[model samples]
Target chain A: MEEIQFWIGIVATMAFAVTGVLAIADRGVDIFGVLVLGLITAIGGGTIRDIILEIPPFWSENQIYVWLALAASVATFFAESFFTQPQIYRWMLYIDGFGAALFAIQGATKAWMMGFGLPVGPVILGVITAIGGGLIRDVLAGRKTLIMSHELYAIPVTLGCSVYVLILNFTPQYAIEGSAFCMLGIFAIRAAAIHWDLHVPKMFITKTR
Target chain B: MEEIQFWIGIVATMAFAVTGVLAIADRGVDIFGVLVLGLITAIGGGTIRDIILEIPPFWSENQIYVWLALAASVATFFAESFFTQPQIYRWMLYIDGFGAALFAIQGATKAWMMGFGLPVGPVILGVITAIGGGLIRDVLAGRKTLIMSHELYAIPVTLGCSVYVLILNFTPQYAIEGSAFCMLGIFAIRAAAIHWDLHVPKMFITKTR
Candidate 1:
């Protein structure tokens, strides 16, 4: 399970790096700038997660993550035009969903493994950690961040995390499997939402005006 | 001196938040989204600073900082349209200069007081902290991050921090005063750069290709 989690994180890093590179393809940013964005998008969320939990930043601890992000970044930068096609956007959305689900579950599980109590802080942090990198990427690329969108982005991660927490309370032995299931559930929902442009109802929208 | 730093931070926060809101003026984002961007622009640098230093996160200790960011965000959201007229972008550049100078000094000084060593690490962090928020803001807005432009942005902060560090080394008695001078220097240079479209020589540009 631990090995699965590690591989999942690596895959998430690759997806994020590629997404970052693709974002800047239209902007004609210098190569250095493009690579920076890609690497930042890849490691940013995990870095924040580790920092908040007072652990050594994950990228610093295992050099593989950094190298992987760099490799993904370089590959994406060179191949960006191919990935930016409208048809590929559909695939990108699914990949994003997969990455989000994997990160959300892993983040929550890590927090729990660190001896954080259930039902509150760790769960919130998990959702935050899962989305943090994407938020940063959107901000850097000059687009609307996930939190501000009407889309079902954060909702899936939140639901997955909550379900995982519930499962932990009921069956400790099956919690890992439960987490993976919940993660897949969130990913499927997100994929569906993207497929149909689904959003939470307007009534749930917090209006300041 | 501490009072000056606090007031400067407040002013910078307001300017950054306003700028963030203005950046999103025509993007069709909701009030919450605008607010999130504003708050992120205002406090994002300092948060990065705290994280790098391994300190208990600042906002968690005193929620006032969070409230201040929120207030600035709200104010920016409502007032942004008024300040984003055609000529406004020019004025914004100078106000942004002010923010850069203030944040750079405050960040460097805080790192020094926190016992981080002299010329290299803290200085780098100071510049990073100073420009970090704006960089993130530009990226998220789908524009080129200002720092990536061949402008004199990071240079001013670097020089200012060097001046401060020099003062701390030779004239410890006047360290605080020297830091103030450093901020003034950064402000002056930043203003000039905006006014004149100044940039460091091409030789300084790193070759990534």
Candidate 2:
């Protein structure tokens, strides 16, 4: 189970790094800036989660995550041109959704294990862990943050987190399975939203007076 | 001692809230967004500091900070027009410099109290606590962060924190006096920079290719 968690984390880190690179590709940021952005995007969410949980940041404890993120970022910086096709972009989105799902579930589980109990705090932590890196990346790249956008980004993560916490509360024995189920659910919703161009409704938005 | 720290924190919170409001006032964000930006700017740095030190976030433990920040934001929203005078703006800058200085010293002292030890970690935490809130505010408002700009914003905080940590390491009995000295130093440098429109030179800048 620990090994599975480790690999999932690594994959998520790499996926987010790619997303970061994609975000800043045409922004005229320098190579060093690009690497920094990728590192921040890959590690930012989990770093915030660990800090809020009063644990040492995950990347600080183990150099593997940092190294992997750096390597993935360097790769993406050089190879971003190859992924400009619409099909490749779509695939990247799908993979990003999958990674977000995994991160959301893992974050909720970690918070639960830390005795944050059911529902609110754990669910929020989960969402933060899933999207915090992307939010930071967007803000740094001078683009609209996912939370501020019309896109259906945070909702799927929120739903997955809430469900994961609920399942954990009711059936502690099925924790691992429940996590997997929640991840799949989140990924499906996010992928569908991407495919259909779904967005939060205008009525839900707060307008400037 | 605790009382002094509490009051200093409150003043800093209010000042940062005002700064946040000023940053987003003309950006077309609504009332709710303004409040969020203000609250985050006021508490954001301290929250980051506590998290890094594995302590409960300060605002979570005390509602006074939250209320004060909200009040400041609301007041700024309604009363901002009255402060358009250049004199008022200059006053705000001076107050902000003082708040930043106070925040820097307090953050270093808190980290030292928490056993973060001499030299590196505490000093870094100090600087983060001093500027983290402002950085978040600027990023959210889609403006350049202070650290990324030519402004001499972060240098004073860094110098003050380094001095505070060094003083604590050598003469523990002078901790309080050392903090005072550091705060004064930070405020003086920041004030001078604001007055003279000082900035980092072009030679130190990294250009994007």
Candidate 3:
């Protein structure tokens, strides 16, 4: 189980780093800037989660995550040409969704381990962990945060997190299986939303006037 | 001493909330959006600080911070007309500077109390607690972060924090007076920057090309 968690974390870090590289590729930023963005995108959510959970930041405890993110970012910078392909862009979206799902599940699990019995705690932590890094990336790049839009991004994470918390609270024996199921559920919903350009209803959006 | 800290925290919350309101006033966001922005701006820094220090978030422990921020934001929303005057704008900047200084000192003190003996720890925490909230606010609002620019903001907090940490380490008896002096130093420097539109030299800037 620990090994599985490790590999999932590595894959998610690399995928998120690639997303960050792709995000800033068109901005004409330098190599250092790209690396900074990549690191933030890869670890921002988990870092925020750890801080809020009163635990040492995950990357700060293990240097491997930092190295993996940096390596992936540098690799992505050199491989920018491949991302120009439309199919690769689609693949990136899938990878991003997968990473978000993995992160959301892990976030909820950590909250449970910390004895956050309140359903709201895990759900909120899960959503923040899934989207916080991307939100930071968008903010630094002066782009609109996905959550601020009607985009169907945070909803899947919230649902998956809530389900995981409920299962963990009710049936301890099924925690691992429940986690896997929730992760898959989130990825499927996110993939569908990406493919169909799905969004929340207009009435749900808050308007200024 | 506790009483002083309480009032400073309250004033800082109100000032930061007002700054948040002013930031989003022209964006055409609704009342809810404004309140969200305001609350984030007011508590974002301290929350980040506590999280990194492995302590529970300060605001979560006390509902007063939340209430104060909400009241300030709502008042600012209704009293937007008063902010049109140039003098009020100037006063707000001063208040913001004062609050930043106060927060920086308190952040350093908290780090010291938590046994952060290293000079780097307290200084980093102090700077983060002083500027972290505003950074979050800028990111959420799609504005460029002040720290990323050449603005003479974080530098003052860093210097003041370093001094406070140094004093607490070498001369513990003078810690209280030293904190006040450092706080004043930070506020004065920030006030000067705001008055003169001061910034670091262009030579230090990183160019994309």
**Model 2, range A30-67, lDDT digits (tens) per residue?**
88878889998888898888878888887887989788
Q: Distance from true position, residue B191, model 3, in Å?
A: 18
Reproduced native contacts, each prediction: 0.18, 0.15, 0.24
Off by over 4 Å in 1: A1-44, A57-127, A133-151, A155-192, A199-209, B24-36, B86-94, B193-209
Residue pairs whose backbone atoms clash in candidate 2: none
The TM-score measured for candidate 3 stands at 0.62
Which candidate order results from sorting by lDDT in descending order? 3, 2, 1
Candidate 3 lDDT score at position B27: 56
Model 1 DockQ reads: 0.12
lDDT pick, better of 1 and 3: 3
lDDT of 3 by residue, A1-209 (tens): 88987897788888899988898789887899889899999999998888788778898889898999999899888889887588987888888899999999998888778765355567757877888888888877777776456567777887788788889889879998999999999999999999998876554433343
Residue range B76-187, candidate 1, lDDT tens digits: 5566655766577667767778888888877887788877866576787788778777776666555567667788988878888888877877898997678778888998
Q: iRMS of every model, one decimal?
A: 5.6, 4.7, 4.5
lDDT of 1 by residue, A29-96 (tens): 77787778888777787777888777888778788878988898888777777777778866876786
Query: What C-alpha lDDT, on a 0 to 100 scale, does residue A59 get in candidate 2?
Result: 81
Q: Please give the interface root mean square deviation for model 2, in Å.
A: 4.7
Clashing pairs in 3: none
Candidate 2 C-alpha lDDT tens digits along B53-117: 87777665566887889899877777776544678867877888888999888888888887885
**Model 2 residue B122 CA deviation in Å:** 11
lDDT of 3: 0.83
